[model samples]
Target: MNTIKTDVAIIGAGSAGLSAYRAAKAAGAAAILIEGGAHGTTCARVGCMPSKLLIAAAEAAHHAMHTDAFGVHIEGTVRIDGREVMARVKSERDRFVGFVVAGVDAMPGADKLSGYARFIDDNLLQVGEHTRVHAKSVVIATGSSPVMPAMYRALGNRAVVNDDVFSWDDLPKRVAVIGAGVIGLELGQALARLGVRVSVLGARGRVGPLTDPEVRNYAERVFSEAFRFEPRAQVQAAVRDVDEVRLRYVSGADELVEDTFDYVLVAAGRKPNVAGLALHNTSLELDANGLPVYDASTLQAGAHPVFIAGDANGVLPLLHEAADEGRGAGTNAARYPNVEPVERRAPISIAFTDPGIAMVGARHVDLTAESFVTGEVSFEDQGRSRVMLRNRGLMHVYVDRASRRFVGAEWIGPEAEHIAHLLAWALQMKLTIDEMLRMPFYHPVVEEGLRTALREAEVKLR
Candidate 1:
């Protein structure tokens, strides 16, 4: 068996692992990165980049078809060549992936191990069949895998997951998204806009990660226009009949709904990739969720030298959160001799669907009206939205009533992402509601919507 030694051992070469590798090196630690999968991160390969490429194409097609409001006249109808669309998506995806892979290839550090890594102990790992890695510290940025229910697996090629959805040469004429979360909504909407009939099935009626009941209801209504949504849909069984996939589900009111889709895309959820690492070899104990105990802020696992980061922790699956966690883990791992925990970033997440759902900082589910005051704005009356023919949305701001601090916000409307970032920064900096409102408010813009919401909250706080 071959033996390799390093100051820091990074398991998985995805975004979290790569970020840890850089942070470790920056912290003056010699590091080795190991991977059993492709070098490109999930975002670049299948999650963000490829998904956005498809969304862009669908948006273009949608706009061309709905140009009537702008007094634009077209003699012919807009159409998408499915095969060509996917080819371009893959082409762009490969380019983004190539950039990341090239960087890994040129990086000079402890030798990159090219195989599955399993823990032999807290500070030791065995790579594949022949290589053993010894390190002063280890970072588990192993990432996660899309959860396709076992029932759906029976459909074989007729069913798709995020990984398979991006690689398809042509899309099916009809698609049923198994979950209404970020991945399902984004891809489902894109497919629908591109002329494919799409439906979403989920046990909850909520859209995006909205925790506020008002925001969730508003988002559901806004998005319902794009695709068929089975709110409170409990899927009991699935089977493949020849070339079509059949789904048997119970709707919100106990009505049985059965449908056959040309392709079933299961965006159910994702499970952290931990089993292969052999966590039992160490002293770590997994929680009920099957995730090892770890401190989120410090990225430390109990008092051990091992650390966890990225989707592997199963906290939040957003790309930015994964990157931040990686740096935190790297810092702790490199400074293990005198290890100190790093401060965690404020929560921020965005759903890249139309109307653009975004949630930031504290959630409404975690607050009460008695302790916090809420401010809201309706885009139905906003100037920019009317001009853009997107005059539909809702925004909410949550502030500590007594302290007047901008704590958190959730919104479902046009440019929700922009508003989210604005408030997220304000909240992160401990800015007061008055401070947020005093920031310039520009007219005839989507951002003005944010100003209105802040003002509404500010008045109530006083």
Candidate 2:
């Protein structure tokens, strides 16, 4: 039996776990990373990277077909080779995983162990056969897995989730995507652009219910033009036989309808991955959803010197948030003797769609400002959006008239993702609307939309 000791033992090598490991090492603590599967986890292998690659490929195909609108005539028919796209996506994913693995391997005083890890005691972990690691503190960053609805169990390997979307060799002739969240809308649009007759069914009022209502309306409009969107629809069951999958749902008037498609991709949502950790052995307690209960401040599970980060804590499953939480947990775990819990700022959520959606701070309804003011600027008014032929989007800003501080911002347009960081910074720094507008912004760029939005907000305040 091989026995090892470290100051910190981090489980799962995903974004959160890797961040924790690096943070602990930088804090001069000995850290060992234990991963059940390969490094990089779902984000690098299947979730974010591969899915975005497919979306980019679809965008390219869409642009090629629509180039005629820009006075460019195509000599022949436009085609998409799914096999080639999958090959490239997989190659890039593998390259990214390799780079992450190499970086983890080179870290000082850090050992990467590959195997299923389980808790043997409070601060002890057993990784595979005969290897035991005892650490003063431990961090769990197991991440998450897509929830497979029971009704679609029969679809099995045919019904893919976010993880296996890249493995699809050929685009389906007709596909049904269950769920209208971020993954569903993004993948649904990607498949639709690849010539698949895509139908999206959701139980919510809009595609992205988690986003602001304005953002959801814009996303619904953009994606509905490409795919069949059945909002406020409840899915009852799915049956797969031979070549096609059948989906049954209830429509507006309680009318049951059935839709048959070549394939169905389930993207309902994700649950925390904390099942096999044997958390009961320690003082760590799980909530009703079987997720670890941690202090929102220190992220500590209990008095067992164990902490939870990333999706395991269920505090927003975004990669950036997970990374930040991991850093906090790692630093706290390594310096538990004297470190104080750091305050976390609110997170910004951004979804990548045709128009792209970015949200920061509180929504309009969440805050109570004496003079609530809002402003919007259309992408059609921007010279850059017009020149790029991507003119269907809007930018909105919210301000507190009394304090004059910028409270929130929402945008659905070109370069909206890049502009969101500025809004997040302004909200974090407590910058006023007047202060933000005084900053000089370059003309003819997408950022001009922000300046315009602030200017319009000033008028609304009056």
Candidate 3:
């Protein structure tokens, strides 16, 4: 076996791994990046970019068909060519993936290694059969993989994951989506708008990542009206029958209903890609789930020279969080004995379904009702939303009663992705409700709705 020595060894060439590699090198440490899978990051290849492209297409179709509300009349039906749609999605997706791959290609050849890596000890890694890597410190940034339920294994090619959706040559006639989280809602709604018959089924009464009960309930009702949404569906069985998949479930009326679909897409969340790493060989402290116990601030695993980050750490799975964690982990690994905690940005997340779903800072479940005041605004009477015929949403801002500061917010509304950013900045600055209200409020704008909510919170503060 070939032996290589380095200051830091990064396992995985995804977003986190790449960020760690650069951070380590910038800190004057010799770092080697190893990967078994393709070089392109998940966002560019399958997760964010591709999914957005599909959503964009769906939005166009949905808008063209619904222009009647704005008194804009179309001569006839808005037709969607599935072949053309998939072609552009695949083409544009490949372009984004190419950019990421080009960046990887520009890296030093000697610093790059092929094949999966396994832990031989705390400081040693066996990379496939060819290389034995001995590093002073190690950073695990292996990212994540989609979780497929055991029941779906019997469906063969009829069953798919979010990763498998982008490679399609044409959109299926009918799809049964399992999971009502971000991925499921975004893709499920997008597919429905594109004229594909879609049924989004969830076990629990959950809608996206909204922890606010009011927001979640409002979103569930809105989406159900928009498409075939069953947030609390109880699916009995799913099996492959020749070409199509047969799915049986209990409907709202408590009646057994059977449906056949061209495909069953599973968006049942993701698990960290740590199982094959042979972590048992290492002495790092592990959690009950067999994952390494690490600090979110430092990304350090116990008192060892090993660190975990990004999806592999399973703290926050968003792209920005992964990049932040990777940079912290890499820098800490480079300066092992002199590691420092990273001050992270306030938490923020968005789901790109129209009207978008977003959350900033603390979640509703994290805040107690007695400790905070909830200020709300409904878009039904908001100026801009009414003019745009999108006056169907609710916003809730949580303010700490003691501090009177804006702690967090969860909302389902038009331009939610944009609104969430403004709220995130306020939370990061620790702005009080009164201070936020005194900032500014422009007229006939969606932000005016935010001002209304803040003003209400300000009144409660008095």
Candidate 4:
């Protein structure tokens, strides 16, 4: 066995692991990264990038089909070549992965190991083929994988999960999406737009259940035109036959219905990849969800030298949050000798759909804040939205009436992703509604919605 020593050893070369590696190297600490696959994590390869590409293509096809609605007549019928679209998605994903790999290689005092990494002890990890790495601090950023319910194990080949959804050679004529979360909604809408009949079933009363009620209502209204959405439905099992994959679900009435589809997509969420890490050798504790329990500030797993980041720790498992957690963990690990830890900041969550969804800080109902006021502005009133012909969504603002500060903001509309960053910065800086509203906002732009929302909030305060 070859033994290697480093100041920090990061397992998983995904977004979180890569971020940690860069932070450690910049802090003058020797670090190494290990990944099980040659390609990067789900976000880069399967989950986010490729899925979004397909979604974009589907949107284009939708526009082409509906050009007549905007007074633009198209002579030919719009058609989507699923195989070609998938090929483009794969190419873009591969390019992004290559860029990530090259960037990792360029980092100083950082090495990459291509194999599965397992914990030998608290401070030691063993990769494939007797490659032992020792470190004073270890960060588990192994991320998460799509959960395949045991009920669908028998329908393995016929069912697809998030990680493999982008690799389909041909789009199914009918797809039964077994979740109503972000992934399921995004995929369901994209496939539906691609001319596939999509049915989304979930236990929640609406799609994107984690989002605010207002956002969920809008999404349900918009997507229901093309998708068969069955909320408050629990899937019991999936059976595969020669012709189709049949899903049996119990509806709110406790009646079972068997829906037949050409394919079944299991997007019910994900589980942490901690099974092979041998965490039992150390004092690290697992939460009820089978994820590593760690201190929010330090990302340290109890008293153990092992640290956790990304989906492994299960703290706001978005890619951006994972990167932030990874950087904090690496910085803290470098200063482990001094026991100085980084303070964790709240994260902003964004969902990318046709009309994006963005949220930052606590909602009015979620906070114990007193003297707070809330305001909302519809995108239908925004001139920019009218010009873009995408006038569908709303912006909501939560203000602390006592301090007049902008405490939180949520939006569902065009450019919501870009506008959410501004909200996050304003919240972090504790900017008051008065201060935000006074700023000059460009007219006929989505950002104008912010000013309009804040102005309405000021009126409510008066």
> Which prediction has the highest lDDT against the true structure?
3
Model 3 ranges with Cα > 4 A deviation = none
lDDT on C-alpha atoms for all candidate structures: 0.87, 0.81, 0.92, 0.80
Per-residue error (Å), model 1, residue 263? 1.1
Candidate 1 lDDT over 1-462, as tens digits, reads 999889999999988898888899899998999999888999999889999999999989988888888999788877789999999999999999999999999987455889999999998999999999999999999999999777888889988898999889997898889888888889989999988999888777757688889988888887777788876799988889899988899987798988889999999889999989988888887788767898766888888888899999988887888888888888789889567676667788898888889888898998875998888999898999989988888888888988899888888888877877777788789999888777888777999888888888887866
- For all the candidates, what are their Cα RMSDs to the real structure? 1.3, 2.2, 1.0, 2.4
Model 4 agreement with the true structure over 1-462: per-residue lDDT tens digits = 889998999898888888888788788888888888764666777777888888888889988887766788989777788888888888898887788767766755338777788877888888887689999998889888888888766786778897677777778789888888888888988989898988888787756634557766776676666678876788877778886887888886688888889878888888888988876766667777655677777888877767788888765778878888889888777667554566555557777776777788885348675567778889986899888788888777888878898888766788888888888888888888888887789866888887888888899898
Query: How many steric clashes between backbone atoms does each model show?
Result: 0, 0, 0, 0
What local lDDT does model 3 show for residue 369?
A: 66
Candidate 3 residue pairs in backbone clash? none
Worst 10 residues of 4 by lDDT: 338-347
| TM-score, one value per model | 0.97, 0.93, 0.98, 0.93
| Model 4's TM-score against the true structure | 0.93
Q: Model 4 clash pairs?
A: none
List candidate 1 stretches off by more than 4 Å: none
- Segments of candidate 2 deviating more than 4 angstroms: 107-110, 209-211, 252-256, 343-346, 369-371
Looking at model 2, the pairs that clash are none
Rank order by TM-score, top first? 3, 1, 2, 4
